[model samples]
Target: MLEFALLVTALMFGGTTLYSFGFAAFVFTALPAETAGPLIRRAFPYFYLFVLATSAVAAILLIARDPISSASMGVIAVTTVFARQVLMPAINAATDSGDKSRFKRLHTLSVVITLAHIGCAAFVIIRLAGQS
Candidate 1:
């Protein structure tokens, strides 16, 4: 049961990570700036909520099952999710509404942080995968 729970948590985090990457790719590549604003506005809130809920559940499951092995991953997962899903979008939204320079700076920072989060998630997933 513990293994199963861990696997489920991993899958949730992995799936959310993939989904976020796909969305980020779309924002970076296909979408025009005009469309990007509207698209992000429409999509980000729901995505944020989804990530938050999933990460929360994953963390709870991890803590309930095995604290030592899973807790680190859970912490990383939660942090990544919060940054990608909550903080970035909020910053982006603020930038969109405010000064161009500020927007660019915030966007750049968000992108770098988000990429780092993805890397962290990937590392956690790989490590946990081997363990389980």
Candidate 2:
């Protein structure tokens, strides 16, 4: 159980890091904003879903052995729901409506939330790892 939890938590960290730094960065650099923008918008949903599923699973797995890690994962899972369902649509609407300021603010919030999720996943991994 511990090993499986660690693996899932690592997947959470790696997925976020890769999507945020690797895929998102590469897409923007390799493609123009007009092209990259829509592509990233499409890709983000999957990213959020990944965060949600993995964190939820990890939370369930860690609940008995490590409440702290489980709680962190739970927070990540819950925040991801808001990010995916409410926040993402708002960002898209802001962009579609040409509300640049609103888009920027919302997009920044999304980025921060994702980064914090990454931190939480990392923390959980570190904490759980020390158990063995």
Candidate 3:
């Protein structure tokens, strides 16, 4: 079970890291903003869903062995729900309405939320896998 929890936590960490640093970066550099923006917007829902589901599963798996990690995953899951349901739509609306300030504010919030989730996942993985 610990091994399985570690795997799931690693999956959560790896997927977010790859998407944030790898896929998103590649998309923006490879395509024009006009092309990349919409493509990423289309993909965000799926990404949020992936985070939410994976973190929720990790939370359950870690609940017995590591309550702290489990709670961290739980927070990641709940926060992701807010990101998907509320923050995402507001950001879209801000973009559509040409509200640069609003978009900046909301987008920054989203970035912070994503980074926090990644940090939490990383911490959990390190704690579960090994001290080193």
Candidate 4:
């Protein structure tokens, strides 16, 4: 179970890092703006869903052995839910309405949430690795 948790945490960390740094960048760089923007927008919900599922499972797995790590994973799961359900729609509304300021603020919040999730996943992995 511990090993399962560790593996999931590592995969979550890698997925976020790669999507943020590699895959998203590659998409934007390789594709035209009209194509890339909508493509990324379409992908964001799935990305959030992935984060939510993995984090929730990791949280459940760690709850028995490490409360601290489990709590962090729980936070990631909850925040991803918020990002997917609330923030993403708000962001789209802002964009659709031509509310540039609102869009920027919401987008920044989304980015910060994603970064925090990534950091927490990395922390959980490091903590688990040190234990064994």
Measured by lDDT, the strongest candidate is 2
Candidate 2 least-lDDT 10 residues: 123-132
The ten-residue window of minimal lDDT in model 1 covers: 113-122
Candidate 4 local lDDT, 1-132, one digit each (tens): 999999998888999989988989999999998899789889999898888889999999999899999999999999999999999999989988989999999999988988998888988999999986
Candidate 1 lDDT over 68-117, as tens digits, reads 54565556556657666667766766766786776777767656754554
- Highest TM-score against the true fold, candidate: 2
**Cα TM-score per model:** 0.66, 0.98, 0.96, 0.96
Identify the runs in model 3 with alpha carbons over 4 angstroms from their true place: none
Q: Give me the runs in candidate 4 sitting further than 4 Å from their true place.
A: none
Worst ten in a row by lDDT for model 4: 33-42
The better-scoring model by TM-score among 2 and 3 is: 2
Once superposed on the true structure, which residue ranges of model 1 sit more than 4 Å away at CA? 73-93
TM-score-based ranking, best first? Answer: 2, 3, 4, 1
Model 3: per-residue Cα lDDT over 4-112, one tens digit each: 8888888989999999999999999999999999999999999999999999999998898889999999999999999999999999999999999999999999999
lDDT of each: 0.62, 0.95, 0.94, 0.92
What ranking emerges by lDDT with the best candidate at the front?
Answer: 2, 3, 4, 1
Candidate 4 at 6: error in angstroms?
0.4
Measured on C-alpha atoms, candidate 3 has an lDDT of 0.94
Cα deviation of 119, candidate 3, in Å: 0.6
